[model samples]
Target: MNTAQLKQEIIEYSKKIGIDKIGFTTADPFIEMKNRLIRQQELQYQSGFEEKDIEKRVNPALLLDEPRSIIAIALAYPSKMTNRTISKKGERRGIFCRASWGIDYHHILRDRLHLLEEFIKEKVPHAKCKSMVDTGELVDRAVAERAGIGWSGKNCSIITPEFGSYVYLGEMITTIPFEPDTPMEDRCGTCNKCVDACPTGALVQGGQLDSNRCIAFLTQTKGFLPDEFREKLGNRIYGCDSCQTACPVNKGMDFHFHEEMEPDPEIVKPLLRSLLQISNREFKEKFGPLSGSWRGKKPIQRNAIIALTHFKDETAVDELIQVMNSDSRPVIRGTAAWALGKIGGEAANLALEKAQQVEKDEEVLNEIDKGLSFFCKDEVGQ
Candidate 1:
């Protein structure tokens, strides 16, 4: 069994199964990535959703016994929604970034990896393999970068020459020793557009990211969004694509390679007001398949309130007032109160004043005061 022939077979099989790109690398410890991860830890820049054990993250040996090679796969997703939803004056909408536009990539990637693993086992009966998507211990970008799948972009995304940065990455560690692919060179020369376009300045520099300020991480947080990022959130209900959108290589890189990765106009860009009162069951039914829903509806609801304020959608004032007064979750209620303040008007002020009388939660009260301060500013202006 020629290893090179086997690698070619795997590559061909990957194409048949719809894996847009595939590459291989030695399962050696990622020395440079470990140092960067340490720096990220010292800087408090990690998103905290990653595997906590740094050793497992950098060393493939810790994950699998005598791992020989790692296979990295990429699937291109649509950058622009083909069937777009209209976000008009009265009908305001919130977005789930392009990454979350379609069926969750985790499921799709895992399925592809599983198929690849089965094919390898058929060829090599003694082969042992382990696969993971974004949530895996190994850094998907690092593996992809080493495996020649793509270069690590300034936006902290894997930017392939064929698909730009609009690709979902996953990897598999295998015992079969396969020839490694040449890693791509750093092609993002003198490009700082991704850093400039970050809404919260999350991209600290070319390849470094401060996840604390990243809207993608911030939106998944269960607590109330910080005051600084509220206005920057725009209409994004989950994740942010500013950095990717700003990349020169990603310009006009709209790929509809996978049907499952296509965005449903209504689901990804849903009406802002509808999310305020969505039931748990309804939220699950509507967004459970999307990766953004993994954090549950609380953050989505909180972000939706902020989005309403971003637009100053007067139509949502009634909905925000109702949420401020009636919602069970303090974070949601408090966010709604703050949104009412940001979207200041007589109805919003009246609602905040009314909430102060009966709202027992201390945090919600503080948010109510914040909301009232906007009216105070308006008064002083007058």
Candidate 2:
């Protein structure tokens, strides 16, 4: 079979395997992507990965290590039943943004891509292919845009008419070249909803994101979250989706019927009271199957405490006190103290006093004192 026929067969097979969109492009866009990465690094927006590693991330040659074409696939992850709006009632909300509300897309997309790769190898006999679901060196979004799968929205996500920016991307690098798809035109004309909706100003400009200010990055980050970022985190115990939620194109997408993508009921909008009690073993058991669990429980638990603090729901005081005593992680204990302060009353004051007696870390002790002072002010006034 000629390369043209093989490409058609592959595209057909991709749709059959459940990928919503598929496109092919030469591994050349990495050149421009590399320059973009350099600019991002210079702006101090690149985090998690080292700036030196930007070359590897942007260089398609490094992705294949040999000449090849890229097969970019996008999976739509919209939800129909879920409301994107922040609840006015202040009920402990389950805030899984449209994209992350289900089974990990990385797993789903990678499995399907592997099937596509195997099919290609069977047809071509000598075809060499590498499949990646957000796990490789290639700029999957850039390749998707170049291949006409979708346009890059101002939110820095690929936007499709059917899925908006609520789609996950995967790529297959192959030695067998195919006719490339034409790139799409940008459609985000005069709309700044995503930028304006961002609570932390993570979107520096159209199609640009500062990871340092991004709540999604902050929630997944290792170590202590800075005080400023912590306060801005609000009730987001995991990834932030304010930008995608505000995108106009995401309207009317069906999220309820996507059973494969439905979040575990317990995880969909975890109760802050229950979250503060998660043991390390429980954390692993609950989140082991989740893509977000890669960072471990510390960050999630810390964020949970922060959320509890933000909610300032007095009912959670006893639970926060329990965490203060039982939780060993300094960050958790510290955050619990902070929560207690936010919920300050007689119960909170007593809990902070008890925590201060047992707390050994200076930071934790200071947090306890800070929490106590909230109620102490009332006592002085009385």
Q: Give lDDT tens digits, candidate 2, residues 313-352.
A: 7777787888888887778888789778877878888778
**Each prediction's number of clashing residue pairs:** 0, 7
Position 116, candidate 2: lDDT: 90
Best by lDDT: 1
Instruction: Determine the backbone clash count of candidate 1.
Output: 0
Evaluated at residue 183, the lDDT of candidate 2 is 93
TM-score of each model, in listed order: 0.99, 0.91
TM-score of 1: 0.99
| lDDT (C-alpha, whole model) for all candidates | 0.94, 0.78
Model 2, position 46, has a per-residue lDDT of 80
List the lowest-lDDT window of 10 residues for candidate 1.
318-327
Model 1, which residues run further than 4 Å from truth? none
